[model samples]
Target chain A: MERRVKLLGTGKYLPARVVTAAELDEQLGLATGWTEKKSGVRIRHYVTTETAAQMGAIAAKRAAEAAGVSLQELDCIVCASGTAQQEIPCTAALIQEELGLSRTGIPCFDINSTCLSFVTALDVMSCAMAAGVYKRVLIVSTEIASMGLNWKQKESCVLFGDGAAAVVVGQTPEGESSRIISSAMQTYSEGAHYSEIRGGGTMVHPRHYANGHEDDFAFDMDGRKIFRLTSQLITGFVDSLLAKASVSKKQLQAVIPHQASGMALRIMRTKLGFMEQQMVDIMADHGNVIAASIPMALHEAISQKRVARGDCLLLLGTSAGLSLGGIVLEY
Target chain B: MERRVKLLGTGKYLPARVVTAAELDEQLGLATGWTEKKSGVRIRHYVTTETAAQMGAIAAKRAAEAAGVSLQELDCIVCASGTAQQEIPCTAALIQEELGLSRTGIPCFDINSTCLSFVTALDVMSCAMAAGVYKRVLIVSTEIASMGLNWKQKESCVLFGDGAAAVVVGQTPEGESSRIISSAMQTYSEGAHYSEIRGGGTMVHPRHYANGHEDDFAFDMDGRKIFRLTSQLITGFVDSLLAKASVSKKQLQAVIPHQASGMALRIMRTKLGFMEQQMVDIMADHGNVIAASIPMALHEAISQKRVARGDCLLLLGTSAGLSLGGIVLEY
Candidate 1:
């Protein structure tokens, strides 16, 4: 019943356009320093000349290089993101084409769990890998959150950035301990509307855009409700995750969590009984990249050597489904 | 090395409003019989009183009933559809809410491969089931393709309909022959743009909808190009799939395919060597239900006794990813 998939390599890509908190304050007409103080995001990247698929391909290429594997050698490509590059063909195909694997015939698809997409995909695909369905797979999380932000909602508008991250995964080598120990996810759909962009879907077609429904096209979030919901559930969720993995809090050397917010991270430290030093907090620089947050933070953690070989790591997040997800893995 | 997942039950739902080709002929200003002759569709359903999530929930309920399982008892809920009901939280969460299981805390997410989504989800989730990830899982493919149809594009416009289908799956019993024999998918991303809806995602945000980009929000298809590309690949793809399953054409008692088009179905028979009787052809009444097509046909196949216990069944399709996918299962 054990999953023996290994995290072969990781990669990340931040857009070239750096939008500082100072710039956001000027754009939103907020007082000087208000943006940084409120959002805890000093600076974040936004897409200027790049598309989500382009960012994903660059990150995928870097991941392939890090894994010492060629893009052509990957058996499958999965785009694990909340947003798609386009509405059709799935983002994975676009990324495959961008990586010049158009003719490689690599199977391409997507697994979406909104902001928890990367964690969800890793857990699901790890089973596929463990079952020998695929030998090598590339999973990418790419987001362009700026395009749909409701700028009028200052509380949520300044909390997002655009970026992409990718990982190459395969079977664990003979002596390596890399494997997914356990994963647990639960959806509280009552909070589904606590955060949403109600447009660009069948419910609100483009024909309704000019018909007094334009606001539905923008992202809207009730941060307080999300916080309240998380506070009510996260403590027990972390206990269940650690219990399922048969690992204690002390066994976790690093926590590569979704860069949800500065306040969210502090809650994990204070309420979830994790030490501050065990957490990988990148919200100050990258902001909330939505589905890209966890993997992006993971790549950063690896570069910083927060987790070493055979070390236990915890990945946790709260997504728009009102979903709480966590995975315990051995690096 | 074999996949031991079993198909427990299947269910489908078409909307209450049935649009016959004659009705379309009048609506589009074409002569009577023109629409039917061109598209080979006699009648297809279009949603009038239902949302995609609502239809999906109905299908899921029926599937659970047929499987003698309760909705609240399933381990996971996955929406395997091309079109979402909304832009955030993922469609699975919406369906979860619609099912009145908001408090059940069942994990929910989505797997998308456009028109082949159901087959892809079945293949992927089957691996998870085989790996002891979950005891029972429900996959729903619900699509309201009519909402995004480019009515101006006559050739592709008439080929779609709205519908929902679902299946409940679990581990095969020890003595049962039910199992997934093989699954094969290949993406020729060269055809990625041949069929697409350019809006609804980051690429063409809603802000650009009124700025002479209205057409970009609609579904567009170069039918001839898609036909050309599919024709160039399907024959070998079928062969590879059958070979992988170690199944021969004669061994497959049923061939459930994505009702992509009437002509596409003809190619499967004439070029791919599947007998007319072995195929489950429902395009005449349902048109193409996008991702819901295959599972809808699958449900029909079971009801009509086209596939019996211990029978071999093939699920095949060409999706917008320019992706070709097929799965051979023991029914």
Candidate 2:
């Protein structure tokens, strides 16, 4: 029989400093209500001093504590972020160092699928745990999109915030309290360039930084295009994913989708047949925290007692690779 | 029962343009034969027109063809690289696009543990396959360290080259073929900063690039520090790793280690008590291909018939996270 993967606990960290949509609109000279009306965001946390890895460490510590698992017991750590604190040593390593788990010799790495990174990493950690490669896996998603912001791109800039979320996953015997059912991920790269930051990699080496456009160095988005494309495909995608999980919509006690945008969430709520009360929506206050979106929302849902033991929760989202991912599990 | 994960095929792509140590020594005005004696690297490939994703795609196609698997059969592509082509959409997505495998809805992501990235990803793919998360998986490691080279840092610059290696992994029924018997990875973050590119991240945002130092944007290394640390613990690390697999030197047919450096390889050959022929040494001609080193070396060993079916093979290496990783398998 396949070993069951269980989520032991969840934690989230939001920076204390807040950047309201109004503040950004005023700063970028946009219409006063444009950010809120368009994206369903009022205010979002923006990091003032805490870095991505730093915030991730805080969230991870809380996760480990909540799980009643010591940091030393985590056999693996996966930092599933679209961005990094640095490109060389991986943000996971830095977070390991920050959490005082450095030198303990546990394996650490990063998995990136942009916004879907959390779900991608969840499935990865699940598979590994189920196969006995690791007993306990710590997964963290921290995105500091504020630093990658392009002031000129008011749309993308105002939509992103800085935050982190973490979860502790472990293998449980059959007939356990909670266990993952099935997970599916699909990517369509035709929209790969729809949301990107072109300057952070070898394609546009740092040597050319002096002459690079701010947009190349910052996040850029064709929000409408992404919405249109995903809207066209999400229904079939979700239906297929639910079928793979052998789950019906009526059985889903809570749906934690990526808090991508106000309109995207609205479409998921309406066109996708999810009740407003069934979905976790934290984008209004947190904005879209990139890879951290879904996990943070899950943490909120759990804390709010929206999902309980014996309940089935569906976590799903869209990512920058034009990737769609979903995971169903009994909580 | 847990499925067995086996290597289906391997392929590699080396750029057409070759740069010899003599040429580099002359170009950089180093002492005569300095590059050769210091690093024992005579020649290395340097890409002129190709990017990391382009070379990776070529390698991926070759791997898929060798495995007799069509692109459509690939369920996942894990780009296990030390560097990415871009920071946003992921190198795997770009490679998927280059390979004409785009819009297929197969999941694409990355696993990064720097130079040990390939082995780390191999274990990841292995576990996922064993758990039946995927029937077929493709893992690629493509590094273009030359782009991040600092011409002034002759020591580090001459030790790196550009290349890519690809491997197709799949699960077979219990009765036939090679299988991953065991895998173990350990990390010590005390040395995380010993080798790094301090730029290209949120730490040194691209917007502040114009004022960044050349070293910040380029790869930096303290070779002696790494050697000192590793040499102090290499023997114990190897012994512990072997014990985990319950295998000994007498049971091993061949070993594939990361092409780190001439001195490092020599130490492994001598102190580790491996015969010259037992270890695959490709550093002299390839320098270090970063994450591509071990897989590329394995490709050469396979083609040379140094490792064949039913033989016990060991894949092991150290990475920038001061990580020691190993996998033992029946080949």
Candidate 3:
């Protein structure tokens, strides 16, 4: 009953338009350097003409190329995203269409756990792939957080960017040591309301807009509460995850976190006892791209050769569900 | 690699407000009997004060009771639905809160394949359960499609209602014969645009609301195109699915199909060769509740004793991806 799953390759895509903190300062009527100091985001990408599916397809292609597999060879496509391209068809279908595999008879669907989508999908899909339910599966995490950002909430608004990342996975070959060691997810819904967009779904239908519920449509977050709730639970959660994996923090070659913020990364290095050099920090550049954060950082880690084959890697993230998700795997 | 998964229990929920086609005809100012003739719906439920999560929680509680498992014992809760309760946090977490399990630390997430969501999640989760990734899981398909219906689109508007269904699954006990035989999903995105809600996501942000894109937020479907495309592909899809399971059409004890429409159900019997008595038909009562359709029908079939233990059951549906998904299982 040994479970085996390998991370074949990873790829990421960022929108072409870059919005700098300095420019945001002018747009939001803030003083120079205030936006950067407050949000710790120097620059972040925002989509202009590109879309969530288009970015995802580019990343998927790169991942397939990196894995030495063709998109046509994929057995299934799972879109693990915080945001959707449209409401009905599921983002994965749009991505399949974008990849020109619409008629390939490949299965397409979506998994959502808000910002932790990629980590959760990787965990679940690994189980499926290892069980021989599928082979050569593609998972894409795409986000356009900027689209839902509420400029009024400068704290949360400046902390988000638009990006997409994708990973190709399959069962390990006979000689490869790559495999998922352990994964865990816990939802603390008591804090679910701490970060959310109240509209765009059934509860507060769009038709209510004529009745003056526009604010419900915008993304809102009480950042301090999320930080407080995450701080209280993450240590125990990570400890339990590592315990299940029978791996120690010292054994991990790298830590790929959700790129939540500069402050959170610093807390990981200092408060959580992880070495600064072991962490993948992209918040300053990419900001928080919601679900794309973890995989995008993983892609960066792999490309930079910071994480090598057979090395233990820790993937962790706290999402809008007030959920903590972590995966320990041999890369 | 033998896979065994058992559906321990099934439950469904509908709002107390039942609107008959007569009522709809009066509301829309249509001729008497005209609404029923076009939509093939006698009555359907619409949420008044209830939310998707509340309905799902009630169904989940019932499913747990039927399964003889406590909500606290579940390893995970997966919401498989086409509609969302909110834009973030995921509908599963919301259901967790509604069930008073917010602090239970069980993992919660969502799987969306539009109308085929329940079928897809059952297929995927069965593999996970059989693989021992999770011991017990709850999957709820809760949708409030009525909230998004565009009244102007009379053809599509009268064909949807609000409801929820849940199933509890685990690895079959040693003496039990229940297990998933085979499953398949194929997305033809060439027909993706035939049914969709173009707004409320990253593609068409709510900020565009002021500029007048209200129609984008409402559900839209070309029913004739969907029927035409489905007619061309569904026969082969079911044939391949049954073939993979090594089960013949005649061997299936019950056909639990998504109650897409009364006409679709008729076509399922007349063209797809499933006997009338073998098919579970609840479209007259529930209309098309999107992702909840298949599981809700399954609950009805199970509760009515129409499908006995160890019976061969075929679950089938066509979704917004223009995706055809089917599962053949020993119930």
Candidate 4:
């Protein structure tokens, strides 16, 4: 029998410091209506360096505890982070070590798909579980997007927050009601150029800083193009995912789209023909947490009783690389 | 019946420029015999300002042509890149656009576990195929490790090169001889401190470049610790992979260890009790290509007729995150 993978637990952590739209406007000298009307973002969280990894670790620990599993039982820990604590050895490893589960023989690594990283990790872990390679996996999506912001560029700076969310996935017998049915991922590299942090990668060569070419490392973005593409792709990907999973839109109890902007979520819900009530929109407070957005939304939805047992949930995420993906799960 | 995934074609692209051990020693002001005696590397390839996405696209095209499969037929493109071109939208998306396959409806994204990324990509593709989600998947591993190196740091700089390699994986009928049998991955987050590039990721914040922090972006390595961990993990992982595949040590045709170093490969072969001829060591010329090394070696081995049909090949790779994994496949 084909083993089904189920999401056993969910948890999220957001930084304590909340930046209001008014406070951000004063910081960046931007017009007030832009943040409220265009993005529908009123406030967002920002992480101090000390709390970023700690928040991720807390979320992961809560996920394990909620799943009735200990850190020692995790076969693998996949931390999806775009805003990492270090460039090498992956922030996942550091998170694992900090969780005091370093002696459990658990393999941990970070997956980078920008905002879509967490879903991609889910897809990878799902495949491994289905293949019987792993019985349980911890997928952590953490980001301190505020840390990477060009604080001076109000256009991009106000659109991010710091947070982490995690889910524990495990193999279960077939025919289980709460299981991941199918997942789909698509990358549009052409769109990759449309949105990005232009510096600090191999392309910019950090060593050039010695020559006074320091401005090359800040985050850059083509906002208009990303907005257009994200709107088009998320809708299409979600529909395709539902089709692939043989689930219908009416069957979905909640659609958890990545919390990029409140406006974007509204548009996606409309495109998916989902009722406003059926959508889990967390962007009003969290902004774009990148990979952590969906899990954060899911955690809120579950805690608020927006999702129930045997109800279908659709997750959609898109980010730089112009990547878009969706997962259909029964919860 | 369970479907099997088979490797239909392989291709690789190494940069045109070659840096010999002598040339490197002169550049770094190191004495002779250091590169040869310490790492057993004599030469390495490096790309000049070429993005990892471009290299991956080149290799993927070649593999697609060799497999006689049009890009439109691919269900997914999994790019294994250590030196990603961007922090968002993934390098895989860029490759998809470069190949004119972006609208082919193929899902593309980057998978990273450092050097073990390609194998992880393979395992992911294998699972998707087994789940009948994708009929054809393209797996590419590309690295521009040279870009992150501190050229003055002889120990770390001498051990990296740039290259890309790709394979076309697709579904085959049950009981096929040339199929992926089993794969395993493990990460030792505790050892993450052993090797790393200190800067350029979210941890250091690319924006920090403007603040006169140049050294934060360069690659850093704790060489001795990595060497010890790699040998032990590679040996153990490969043994477990072989056991899971139900193959005895004597039945293995060849072992493709990551091309980190010639001495490492030699030692691993001896420790694992494999004949010297059964190992594919390309580091004597390529040094370490990070994620690209194994596939580059595999391409060379196949071209040289060192691997044959129906033979059992063990693929192993380990890198930062202190991650290690291996797969047993029938050639």
The number of the candidate with the highest TM-score is: 1
Question: Which lDDT tens digits does candidate 1 get at residues A1-331?
Answer: 4689888899999998999999999999999998888888999999998999999999999999989998888999999999988789799999999999998899999999999999989988898888788999999999999998999899899989999999999899888888899899999998999999998889988678788997898998999998988789888998988998999999999998888877778877889888889999999999999999999999999988878889999999999999999989998
- Candidate 1 stretches with Cα past 4 Å from truth are none
What would the TM-score be for candidate 3 when compared with the true structure? 0.98
User: What lDDT tens digits, residue by residue, belong to model 3 across residues B188-214?
Assistant: 888889899998888987667556898
Q: Compared with the true structure, what per-residue lDDT tens digits does model 4 show for residues A86-182?
A: 6666677778877886545577766777887888788777877877777888888888776567665566766787888999888765666667888
Over 4 Å off in model 3, which ranges? none
lDDT of 1 at B171: 84
lDDT score for residue B255 of model 4: 84
Error of 2 at A258 (Å): 0.6
Q: Of 2 and 4, which scores higher on DockQ? A: 2
lDDT for B255 (candidate 1): 92
Q: Residue-wise lDDT of candidate 3 within A216-299, one digit each (tens)?
A: 888889988988988889899999999999999999999999888788888866767899889999888999999999999999
What DockQ values do the models have?
0.83, 0.69, 0.72, 0.53
Per-residue C-alpha lDDT of model 1 across residues B1-331, encoded as one tens digit per residue: 4688888999999999999898888888888888788787899999997999999999999999989898978999999999988889799999999999998889999999999999889988888888788889999999999999898988788888999999999889899889999988999898899999888799988778898988888998998999898888999999988988899999999999889888889877889988899989999999999999999999999988778889999999999989999999998
TM-score of each: 0.99, 0.98, 0.98, 0.94
DockQ rank order = 1, 3, 2, 4
Candidate 2 C-alpha error for residue B232, in Å: 3.3
The top-ranked prediction according to lDDT is: 1
Ranked by lDDT from best down, the candidates are 1, 3, 2, 4
In angstroms, the error of model 2 at A114 is 0.8
Off by over 4 Å in 2: A1-3, A173-175, B1-3
